[model samples]
Target chain A: MTSAVLKPGLTPSRVLIYAVLILACLMYLVPLVVMLLTSFKTPEDINSGNLLTLPHVFSTLGWVKAWATVRGYFWNSVAITVPAVLISTAVGALNGYVLSMWRFRGSQLFFGLLLFGCFLPFQAVLLPASFTLGKMGLANTTAGLVVVHVVYGLAFTTLFFRNFYVSVPEALVKAARLDGAGFFTIFGRVLLPMSVPTIMVCVIWQFTQIWNDFLFGVVFASGDAQPITVALNNLVNTTTGVKEYNVDMAAAMIAGLPTLLVYVLAGKYFLRGLTAGAVKG
Target chain B: MATLELRNVNKTYGSGLPDTLKDIQLKIAEGEFLILVGPSGCGKSTLMNCIAGLENISGGAILVDDADISQMSPKDRDIAMVFQSYALYPTMTVRQNIEFGLKIRKVPKAQIDQEVERVAKLLQIEHLLARKPGQLSGGQQQRVAMGRALARRPKIYLFDEPLSNLDAKLRVEMRTEMKLMHQRLKTTTVYVTHDQIEAMTLGDKVAVMKDGIIQQFGTPKEIYSEPANLFVASFIGSPPMNFIPVKPAGGRGRWHVPLATDLGQLSLPLAAGDADLDQRELILGLRPEQLALAAEGDSAVLQARVEVTEPTGPDTLIFVTINGTKVCCRLAPDLAPAVGEMLKLSFDAGKALLFDAKTGERLARESKTPAEGSAGNVAQFRGR
Candidate 1:
């Protein structure tokens, strides 16, 4: 009776398709279910029960300890990811508007150079970026990590926004110009209002990227300024400690929850924005 | 109302590339409607953009009220344009789109509301003021686009094929509305379109352009009746003007083309042209409406077999062979002819135009259109 299933005599291929879809969904969600169950269990319960079993007498010891250990660094992650996402997305929108609309000589070559940055490996810029950060006396600080994430995230954000804005009619810009709107006014009043879907995609993408980033966080920051990802890794891999699997699961859950929440809340818009060009109005 | 003039304006995208607009010259009187018309890739739209200051001309001056505005930006130039796409701001309501320019100029809030009200009422879009452009139909969007321009009392208006996107019924309705609006406002306006019907029905002055050059600039009647060259004559008519290749028969500024007939070839006398026409072949230009069914035992009629007949709602078309060229004659629907029947067609000898076969220039340059009291018709016609 459902609308989406393949109909008309229930062919063998349809059954095979439904089988594969269900199997893939379980494969993805199995580890997440295990992590959530373990995070709510005691050390004894985690060791005794299997990955799929419910907790034997629920406990809060792992979550409390994990929260105590990573709360400061969790706040540090917020400080870094929030500013990086906002600044990078804002700057990318402006960059895209200028590059696509008010083009001058060599703008194409300049955009080509910017696109080159998108494919460059993060390891390729680690040394030079660190040296520059050191020269500016921002090394080993949360500000340094924020700067690094913003710089690295700009390539994708600009790409998303530029591709989105190109579909907008150029006549809109010309009409606004004839209506006496200047550059920033046109961008803010005319263009930006129509960019909500793309903005959602960029924000969701940058939140997940910056939140899960280990390379920039571990390299450019340390000590009191380390983000939650670095703290989670430290908690899981400490050499002179007991192997607390429950605590490690709780910490991992803490580090992964923000991205999960973003995808769950705004996932449909993200998919729509990605496939916007596939079908036209 | 304002007078707009362009003195030898030229535009090129790059140095070595061919010019997109070449040495354009136009002078429009106060409150006159000038229509720039041509096929696509001609420089009519480019000329409109230059007048709106959206594009910078490579050379020459644009005079508005006899003061040069070539260096000003689009906002400073005080001109508004309606794009062919009706580029209504997708994010703004109709009222806000109409009020955008006035708000940018820092007009008072009360004055801006009044201006928006006046323009919305004039365009009959007061019902759509609260809705977005995407919510309206194509014709409604077109009205909102016009309202956006009319809200600003600029010196001149530039319309770049504003009705080109509408359906046939809507385009005709909007065309009549456009004429009424222009008459009521009496604002200096320059419109661009490739539709020859729009050029004929809506312009006080029309400029037909091709290949970055103004082919002919005159009134619509002059453009229709007496074109300056072969391109203008051919491009300005529906079903097009027929051109027949013929050899001249006489000399001493009096020429006639030899047309092939059933009995034999007959000399069709045209206006007096120079002896140079007799030295080379000539192209005879005639419109479909100019030819009619010959009366019984007409002395000067050309005889040919009707090859095909098309019965349109208003008029029937008769196709016949004239000097080995297929020519169409428009007749009353009641006067339909059968195929393969012998038909005699008579045309006004004086209305026929002669052009050089090689150069496409009009041969009778000195002849002008007849005045109201004069019996002189074609021999006294003037050309650009």
Candidate 2:
């Protein structure tokens, strides 16, 4: 495969293409490398050295400071993101199964309306959402943030799952039905098992969306319930005697790490899911 | 085992649209293999779906063992269907696919395992039990699909063109395998296919459908030799039955159909003495195999210039024009006349059929001497 891609002999054009690809890779990695380097530097090293240089004195002080400030909100993000991802994903699977397989009157229209949610601007709904949450006495709670993320994330998750299930032959459903499987039985025994790729896509998408969300997190949650993104912003914006650039970078990395870890772990499935959803849809 | 029946079954897409299936009536005795054969858009698949209760009938009842199952859900109907696409669950291993139905019925784990093993052994797919469907070849997947159905002893097995996706050679092999499996199980089965050869060979009873209506329903031999209409005659045979236009030839109580050749016109006598045959347009149908090279002393002989010849290995097909209608005659390869050669062809009038040209309906009603001693024909048409 590599020989097929590279061809037998390399021409100047091939060399040029390789040069451009390497340059593009370095361009993308520069910021990440700078962030890592900055997170390892002591405040004195950061002050003395250029941003790209290795720390003159490597230290754990930045990480310790960042963790002290961000740990509670990191747990809050976990508390909010996990249940939100699970509920939305489950709801998406059910919606996808019904819309694709067991369709009834107005199902297409119902799905159309659900898909319309994907385009609704969060800014436009944020005020009304906050008002409703306050009326329901769920404002400023992790549970409220969970509800917010799940509701907002459902459209995308359903789109992923519906497109995936649509590619599955309807004959499988009919065969299962004849095999004495009812709705849930067919979903559990047939549809769900075939859905690992799409589920991975949805969870990754929703996890990243909910975990990285600052607007909803800052607006709907506060103090003890604030997610890492909101907490990081507050920590970085605090007016103080001296700015802790290393701590801010460390804090930002901490805020970003779960999604990065998720992608790193399941990145192959993430890509497969996207392309599979595209082809099927 | 079950006796399956469709009574006045009708299916229409909606109130304004035409019916997709119209007044389909059929019966299959216990362990009988019924073949529903038709071209695309002929509702053969729809009838199979209706019988499986996957599609609801707009008008009538479906019965199994004399009990109406039209209202029952597909699962409650005790029917298993093998689809054209196989529909094997891609996520399941072969064993799990075969065991799925039993598991759904909440059968004990041990029994399910035993049934899966039995089916795997029966289908010769025991080695494939650990592999997912995507890992297997098409033929292997087909076997696993059959195993899934065979794992459960449903009242009936419905095969909707199950062999359609296989290559021609594998289809023939699987066709025989299907017959052998059915013989061992003795399950009532309904198979749908567009292939006339499968219809003829696999069916104990064959239903030839056209435009959502059954054109003919009879034993395979009966359908072959004594078709009910021009459509049935044309649809059921390979290289199809030839239709020659004929008009009354004389005023006497005799009728002759005209045949054309480049040399001259020849005439053949029609055995039917019905008065309605006079001064009326008619069509005479004869199967290609029924027309042969004329030998010395053959009674009904006509000379024609061969237009084309196709050698199909087992037999050569000779094409000639009769009354301006192209006629195909199947004959032994050695005796096949070359194109443009003058040839004498003889057709037995006893095996010939007549139909009303306008209505396309069969005109003559006479007892045809059964050429082959096929069991279904003997039992179903003995009195006729």
Candidate 3:
């Protein structure tokens, strides 16, 4: 009926749009579903004539073997990612606050130079960065990878925090100053508390970037210090043994789970932070 | 309470540019409430920022309680301000917003709690203590802003058009509440507003500024009755002071202004006359209340046809033309005249003011006693 279309219920156009959206979602989700099913499948079931079908017999052997193989690299990724995310986010926050609030001569040019870092491709900097890391006595170590990620990640994190904090009213800063709050007090009490959403966005972005990084892990770290991403690559491509597709799938899922969990946990704030126009002039 | 003084204050955004504030000078005694009123772009907010140490003055020293604080930061200046937008901490509850200043000062937790409760009860926002700023209405946010300033017993409080964002009725109510609060606290304060009514009613002293210059500074009564220039006279009144061009009549010693009305023309005697008056054109500044309904035997009455009538509850404004300039005459609602009808209007010659037509300055006048009934007329007009 015409009333049905006019009311809050679905119309023909709505159904069409929903159908397209569902198709797109399913297309994107197929790989994740296959990875999850294969991680829980025995090697025999994976090779059977049912690539798209659910596992007829479930097994944890693939997961057990994958965990045993990549556990050390998994811990290395954790060690490299946590410090990189924290240090980059903190430095970005201070840089953002100064750039937005305590502007001095040539601050805009400085921010522009920092923004230029975001556009520089890793391939362009790889050789020089490795040389610099060797001179600094940090090459082929997890610490070297941490240093690289923090340095590269700062450009993106600083951009996010600066744009976010620019939307905060200057009057709030002035008010806090009048209330006897000096630099750090104002930052800790007024600005930082109001920065929860922006921090979520920055932290999540940095976490995912550092966790999923493969080139930095391979070039800057070695056998004992390489992150899980590099180890997973090596494990999957090694042609010396039987092709353990189930084990490779399980290791890939393990490498991606942390970032997926972070997105799921803080996705609402992520969206709001992306769109909030916090203050009017 | 403290005396605040600004000596030869000057501000310019950059070299080779016109100054935004020019050699401003003002002084407020302890516990005095000074209102800075002007139209938009008048540098009133700029002046407020200079006084609050939010903006450094390019040229002078600002002193509080006889101590020059020009070099001190805003926090060290020991002053509080209420911004026009309220500027409440969005993430904090009302109680937390009020306690923020004291907390920053490292006040004890017990004292902070007591001060928060006191201001909440004083502003009648106790029920809203746990609510965030976004959850509150505009008026509630305004009270929370005021409460934040009030919680800090600073040397001076600055309010930069705090009630400007409120609706008309709420503005009026808050205006009264502000006056009452000021009376109770007796704290030295400077308030900036564009509303003339607020300037007239709330200020112990009013400073009118325009184009970055202080046009006049005095009590409200002096500002209304003895304005120093044409701009001050024109800016301070509602239904603004009417200006009619007039030519001098009679000899130099005894000047009269000839005004054209519906009844041909009439010459109103000037209270002050000078030898140079006959050679220069003049403007006559008259408030609407100065023009009244003429009695039957009134000697100096000008007849004019009413162009329009606006009844504003307590009184009616009748618009008429004299010398081709539309003039508004405030009369009681009972005397509402019909449009296009001729009415006899009498001008109070003793209350009339003369301005130089060329420079917009008040012409020198001979000393004369103040008008008797004008005070009562001003009271009646303001009572509405």
Estimate TM-scores for all models.
0.95, 0.94, 0.93
- Model no. 3, DockQ: 0.80
Please give the ranking of all candidate structures by TM-score, highest first, separated by commas. Answer: 1, 2, 3
Model 2 alpha-carbon miss at residue A187, Å: 0.8
lDDT of the candidates, in the order given: 0.87, 0.88, 0.88
| Regions of model 3 farther than 4 Å from truth | A1-22, A278-281, B368-384
Pairs of residues at least 3 apart in sequence or in different chains that clash in candidate 1? B367-B380, B367-B381, B367-B382, B368-B380, B368-B381, B368-B382, B369-B381, B369-B382
TM-score for chain A in each prediction: 0.94, 0.95, 0.94
**Candidate 2's DockQ:** 0.83
Q: Which ten-residue region of model 2 chain A has the weakest summed lDDT?
A: A272-281
* Residues forming the 10-long window of minimal summed lDDT in candidate 2 chain B: B375-384
Docking class of 3: high
Q: Which ten residues in a row have the lowest lDDT in candidate 3 chain B?
A: B375-384
Reference-based lDDT, residue A253, model 1: 90
lDDT of 1: 0.87
lDDT of 3: 0.88
Off by over 4 Å in 2: A1-12, A277-281, B366-384
Better of 1 and 3 by DockQ: 1
Q: By the DockQ metric, which is better: model 1 or model 2?
A: 1
Judged by DockQ cut-offs, the docking class of candidate 2 is high
The digit string of per-residue lDDT tens for model 2 on B1-384 reads 899988899999899998998888878899999999989999999999998888889998898999999999999998999999999988898888888899889999999988988888888999999999989999999999898888898999999999999999999999999999888889999999999999999998998888888887889888898787888889888989999888857644467777767767667877766446767899999999999888999877888899999999999999998888899999999999899899998888877888888888776543333323344443221110
Query: What lDDT tens digits, residue by residue, belong to model 3 across residues A1-281?
Result: 88865785677888999999999999999998888898888888888846578888788888999999999999999999999999999999988999998988999999999999999998888999999999999999878888999999989988988897888988888888888888888888888898888888988999999999998888889888989999999999998978988899999989999999999998888888777645434
